[model samples]
Target: MQLTTFFFVCITNASSTQFWPGFKILLVTVVVLLAVKNYKFLVLVSHALFLMIP
Candidate 1:
């Protein structure tokens, strides 16, 4: 499930030509922290809203 969320988030940006490098870096950092912190529930739901980020 986490992998799915991560994949979607990354793929969403993958097609963009003007994506900001720092934004992607920050998102990866945040996702890692969320995973490390054991916030599974949040990580699950966040993806729904994450899809709307752009």
Candidate 2:
């Protein structure tokens, strides 16, 4: 529920290209932090994101 809401919020709020660089930086930071804790989890997330994109 919370995840869906967050996704919707991001989609709605980030209609401008200006928001993307910050979003990418934030996502990379998160992935880096997760990688430090569990590299496999980061890989899984990266794969999922890649598949979601194209």
Error of 1 at 47 (Å): 13
1-54, model 1: which lDDT tens digit per residue?
A: 766566555646643546677876676666566657666735653664466466
Error of 1 at 33 (Å): 0.3
lDDT of 2: 0.53
- Residue 24 of model 1: what lDDT? 64
Error of 1 at 46 (Å): 16
lDDT (Cα) of model 1: 0.59
Which residues of candidate 2, in runs, are more than 4 Å off?
1-19, 48-54
> What value does the lDDT take at residue 11 in candidate 1?
41
Q: What is the C-alpha lDDT of each candidate?
A: 0.59, 0.53
Backbone clash numbers for all candidates listed: 0, 0
lDDT of 1 at 54: 68
